[model samples]
Target chain A: MTDPSSASLSSAETDDGAEAWVDPERVSLKNVLLPLLTFSVLLLIWEAAVWQARIPAWLLPAPTVIGEAFADWWRELLTHSLVTLYETLAGFALSIALGVPLAVAVVYSPVLQKTIYPILLALQSVPKVAIAPLLALWIGFGAMPKIIVVFLVCFFPIVVSTATGLTAVPPALMDLIRSLSASPYQTFVKARFPTAMPHIFVGLKIAITFAVIGAVIGEFVGSESGLGYLILVSSSQSRTPLAFAALVVLTLMSIVLYYAVEYIERLMVPWATKT
Target chain B: MLASSSLEVVTTAGSIDRPKAGARAVTKIQIFDLYKTYATRTGRTTALQKVDLDIRENEFIALVGPSGCGKSTLLKLITALIKPSRGKILLGGTLLDKPSREVGIVFQQPVLMPWRGVLDNVLLPAEILGLDMTEAKARARELLELVGLGGFEDRYPGELSGGMQQRAAICRGLVHNPSVLLMDEPFAALDAMTREDLGFELLRIWERHRKTVVFVTHNISEAILLSDRVVAMSPRPGRIEKVIDIVLPRPRTLDMQFSPEFKAHSDEIRALIRRT
Candidate 1:
């Protein structure tokens, strides 16, 4: 008991120390001001360096120019951002919808896991970027191909994490449940699934971060309208500022989606984030 | 290893209050020549052999041994979490091949789900057993109160101290009101002070609502202090070495441990363990 308790500190009290508890989610001015200040300083340095050097606009646009382009192409940016967001959301949703159930199967069925795991790992090895063109070629340049690429990138992590969480139920907890004569399904619903929630959210968060990148890659391969397409067309046409604006929008989308998952995690599994 | 075709499993040390022949009716758990062996890479390791014991209804029996002793294996066997390699365990005279709802267990760790609140954690067994939620919740509240965790129902396991968490775990073990409560060194993880406090708390809880308890601990004083009888076992091929009935008065006080009788019991147990 002594050594085992010391060993499983990760599962033990990693967080709840004697230090007074701070609500992790509450937004404070000190938290926002530091990042905001750093961002402003970086942007100022870039803007000043660009102005002093008189760098060619096509080579690198100043923050002001990017901001101007952002304002000038507001309508276009909004349309493209919405399209990219749709693909990202759709692809991520698909991954989660398919991935979680697949994880449960992998955890429960050894035969299924043995058969499918190697194939999954192999597919993971083939770069999502490499798969994008093939996906586009097969599906013929639409939201479907981009969504599939997004799905591909998001799929592996979700399944891996979900499976890990599902299988990593504390042995003592399993014993306790076993002592109750809980049916497999009952054990799953009552114990395994809830135990896996924090872990599942970890996968979901990682997959969500990849979701936008996947959509952009799909658009880069071949697409009509999206931030990826906008960046591609604008940069090829020497609309550097416009492309930068699109890139910025994509980044914002990624951050927003990541936070959305985190917010959901905080809401659903409040006990998990206590650390 | 000595060759012995016939083995005497039960060893009653000093004076024992032998129950009448009709006492079989009160026997909640009957272990008959129970053996457990684990097939390891080297060879088959016998964890327990020819262990016979009868735990009476509401009797508090503590199984004490050093590390590698099969006290834990015995507890699991009684819970039917793992089947004995040989012999049999009968719970209330029925052959216990699989774990039933009648057995409740608390491990060394709290094992409370971090995600669940204290109330929900306590009510888990009730939920699993398909008991009435309302009644179970009522009983759960009562139990938490019994353990002095009355106002902490909404708190998560992480927010509680180690002793508090174990107290909640005890509440959980007793929530379903199981006939047999198997605790495997439940207080061994806490600091010495918290361990003692929780030991008293457990005795208080056990006294009010009695259940057949088989408490396993390496702590000699703890086993002696909490149990009605201390079943001391040896290591390696784990078998009962001696069973000493604690004749200490009810509502056992800490001062009783300093008494000559307690010292005599501890010395005898210490000697038996050291002889190996």
Candidate 2:
């Protein structure tokens, strides 16, 4: 309701006509240093608490111990991370490949929407964890099973978001396009699709996080590789630091992928996402 | 039944007023016995009850009415956005039975695609119409200049003021060069000064293009200032209550709006609307 775009656009424009908000000199060092300093203090407290309390290293290992475990198993951790990354990437790609077109079809055709949308919603509601074992059984516990499980997890959000984006065009906008004698496809490509980009990105970002978790679940069910497998192997052998190291890598992977999608969304929909 | 009979008589009477050009009547648009009804929760409510009108080519005709008087509905019917319950709308010599590119519509809102630059926004119609990209781009640049948006071509709709955005919408509407330009309160959202400026600007554009414009507005003065003829309508079962002809000379400006002639016509329309 507020004309936020106008306010922001004008404020961000500098006297010399450059966008000054992105200037490093304007960004306070405190903004970066404060967060880092706080995190370091928390880590020190964690190490001191463990030592003073005489806690077993297996229960909650110190940062130095975790670093040692990380260095010792660096090769295995990196290898497993790659496998998980590939599975997640493959599943994410396949889901997008299948979901976007299917969403377009569903949104464009009432018949397909009426028939398939409810079933898709039902699939999403079903805990995909329950189906991991069945997938492992059918796909023979290789990358295929993990990939399929990840695909199932990621597919719904893309479909739902894409469909919503397609349908969310303002009625006035549609009328404006229609008055030009625009064909259905042209209306979609020109007006509806661009307008829906922000909403579609919402679904994509949500799916990316779930995609990582799904890949981990696939590894948990039956896998010779992946962070999930490493965590399982380390915990079974009381190698908590090793498991903690695998977890740190997995969290980093998820955050990095999620932010990557966010960055693209920002670049593409700069106008719509001013809020 | 009585309304339907009267509607038939009105349609015939309206056609008789049509000036024939060398035995070939060159009416830009013809609405014969137009009626539109909406099925509401309670019952069927008649929005427009058997309306008939004949618009001459290159004439600026204003359809002014009260709220619920079906001015917007009539505009939609003319643009082929909605079908009439019983009637025929003819554009040029061809009956506009379906939505076609023959008419360009400017809605109350700018409705520009926010994601697109001002240049791209103006080219929206061409994109949807699938015209030659190079030609459309050329025409879009021309239109941007025509609308006084030459320097701000790369700016997005979000970057423009409300007045500028509406101006861009006008460019988009006229880009396709349709014979009939349908405007539904396009300047109603603008401030007073901007709206007046745009009204004169539109008049200037109309003089240059000489296209038939069916302008819909609720403001009596706007209708009187811009229209060659002002058709006033009643509320509810929308019916044409009066039609006042402005025999004022061409190239009328903002000052003309305060002239005795303009005020007289404006008062005439105001009285007619109030009576409705």
Clash pairs, model 2 backbone: none
Tell me the tens digit of each residue's lDDT in model 2 across A120-154. 99998989889999998887868989889889999
TM-score of 1: 0.91
Could you tell me how far off, in angstroms, the CA of residue B119 lies in candidate 1 after the best superposition? 1.6
- Give DockQ per model, in order: 0.45, 0.36
Q: Give lDDT per model, in order.
A: 0.86, 0.83
- Model 1: per-residue lDDT, tens digit, A71-176? 8999999999999999999999999999999999999999999999999999999999998888878889989999999999999999999999998789999999
Worst 10-residue lDDT window for candidate 1 chain A reads A1-10
Query: Highest lDDT, which number?
Result: 1
Give the true-structure RMSD of model 1: 4.7
Clashing pairs in 1: none
For model 2, residues B9-54, the per-residue Cα lDDT tens digits are 4344332322323443357887888899999999999999878777
